[model samples]
Target chain A: MHPADEVLVARYVEEADQAAFRTLVDRHQERVFGYLRGMVKDRDVANDLFQETFFRVIRALNKERGSYTRQGKFLGWVLRIARNAALDHLRARKKWQDLGNGDDGDESAWWDRLPDDGPSALESVQDMEEADLLKACIDRLPPEQREVVLLRHESDLTFREIADMTDCSINTALGRMRYALINLRRMMEEAKRLEHIPASD
Target chain B: MHNGKKDILLHLYGEATDAEELRSLLRDEELRREHAALSEAKFRLDHLKRERPDPVIMDRILAAAAGEQGLPSSTDRKDRPAVARSARMRKVMLPALTIAAAILFGVAVGWFSSQPGTAQVDEPAVATAPDDIVPPESLYRFVPPQPVTPASTQDPRLAWDDSAPLMDMHRRIESMRPEGMLDWGEQAVPLESLPGSGSRSLQLTGSNKN
Candidate 1:
């Protein structure tokens, strides 16, 4: 949550500042945890990967003798860590399969929304419908296209960064983005229309 | 009407050479609607990011990496092959190390040759230190000079080089002396002393051998 996580991170390395580290964890844990959950689809697996991300940071911090590079850009690097952890987990399991719906269910429908506020609205039900529809649409995409869309759009990473995080080239990243957009259009046109949107159950 | 150039939407998003032309293509109402629809669908897909992770599984990952995965920590960083480190070092160290090793090998050969009396040394050379380190003044100290013992009987090989020609010259001189001309029963000189006198005496003795 720090505007620049680098400073507190650097301090956390230099000094064994548990408070500083906790601050960092508290700030970014939600988003990071959310990301891993989105990736592996299993609650246990996502949590394991999330814990491993911090463990790796600690190990790298301690082993390298108390020096750290914030690298000005932190989320991309952290996401790369999460992405690698998921891939490695997948590889170890010998199950190169499509990502599944994660535990606690996916609420990705909050990412790109036109902000809504009604005078007496207890909830904005359109968002939930959007989230459910988005989930179905994502599930329907080819695995590669699906991953590219998730990493770039929902994860809010640039295409080149996604390429690096996913172990692909920038050009491949661009191509995937292009195809993902084209496919999104096709999938939307195919979805059956409902007369009235349902409120959240 | 779908402009034949609808593919240019990707270029407009990317760094295409013909971006202005793509923008012009987007001005068409049908293509514009299609683009808007594509954007909306993408936005819908992009927003699905509010997933939560189960807490218990996170504990295990940290535990496993911490070596509490039911095993004690192997804290030593030794087992990992230096492949990654060497790969990282290749940028600066590989060439520098190569040049340094070459210089060291050259210096070693030069020093070995110049240390005087290496011909008498029978031991094969061994590398004593790293190739990059310049040997201190003390490095040559261990290469003790072999004690040059003067032979009492003389090596036949040394004698072949030193005393053989002189002996032959002495015999020839004795034959030429007509006997009783000098000591040793036939005026022959000692085989060892003639060449020991110097090159001038050896040449004279050789000339007189006939």
Candidate 2:
């Protein structure tokens, strides 16, 4: 466990430390955001799920840390919650929600969080072109494989646990990952011209 | 080992505990080249992605876990009015749930006893209801009877099994030539006696052989 995480989890256990909770929020905010963002393939929805995950962890910790089994894998637990939240959100969105709850950034507010600074830092990176191309390829994967890949990359989870989480046999889990890699490689190779441009730095 | 899933494999090999040894083996140039070139691009992506986790994320996780921020406390402080209210709520909810369960049980019992079937749908009959319902009175259920086939006392083919020695003797006797007649020297006299003796012939033919 990271020292920062330990302190926050410990504080979360002891004094209901909001600062410690905030510390956790600051650290994981972007990754969690990016992860959900990638999964739902949307930013605003991802943001909502990310916040919900934190709050749920908060509630659960408050309910009692001891009540949670020491399964020796907290990251997996956290991501499971995140995945569930994202799935729940997707379900809600499909159910045709009204925006009456008061958050206007739905569909109309943002066109791309990719910044207006003329192809941003991501564009400047040597591998940025490759990364984006690769991301697009990853997005093309079958939903099941795509999710496994995203969770594997974006969230730190073991393949075994990913198998368990996804309700797949271990080999099946590994197989999906294998195919995801293969398809990604094929796509990257196909997009070699685009991939090599390195975001045109 | 794969399903076009190079990225995750790369991450797993470099990062997950199981793949540490695998990663170490990749120190070989040929292996690395093979991996990067033709073996798969997914592994390369995974390797790329397996770089150190964002420290900020870990920090945030810890902070949130320890309640360093405005997260709720596990123990309700004795002095807080909220705790008192929650306790009161729990005190109220527990019995409410128990009562609800009891009512469900009662309903289930009524449903079972009023059955329309040939068997008496008595209280005991309702006992066969699932355990989720109240303990049913009747333990009986429509158990199908097991079929029985009586064991035979003995196999009727015993005479055939006992004919092995006789058949062997008969085969040797049939293979006999006048020149080899004496080859059955020890049984030659007995064989002669059998042909001459009516009683022995009758026994050899069997009682029903006529």
The per-model DockQ list reads 0.19, 0.12
> Which consecutive 10 residues in model 2 chain A have the weakest lDDT in total?
A96-105
Residue A37 shift from truth in candidate 2, angstroms: 1.6
RMSD of each: 21.5, 30.2
TM-score, candidate 2, is 0.44
lDDT of 2 at A73: 55
When only chain A is evaluated, what TM-score does every model earn?
0.66, 0.68
Name the runs in model 1 displaced over 4 angstroms.
A64-69, A97-129, A193-201, B1-25, B28-34, B54-210
Runs of candidate 2 with Cα error greater than 4 angstroms are: A1-7, A64-67, A92-128, A193-201, B1-12, B15-34, B37-210
In candidate 1, the residue pairs with backbone N, CA or C atoms under 3 Å apart (3 or more residues apart, or in different chains) clash, namely A47-B58, A108-B47, A108-B48, A108-B49, A109-B48, A111-B47
Worst 10 residues of 2 chain B by lDDT: B1-10
State the weakest 10-residue window (summed lDDT) of model 1 chain A: A113-122
Per residue, candidate 1 scores C-alpha lDDT tens digits across A1-201 of 354577766666677665566566666666677666655556677777787776666665556323235676566766666766777776676534543322222223322321222221113323435555555555445455656676765566665566676666655555555555666565455443331445448
Model 1: CAPRI class: incorrect
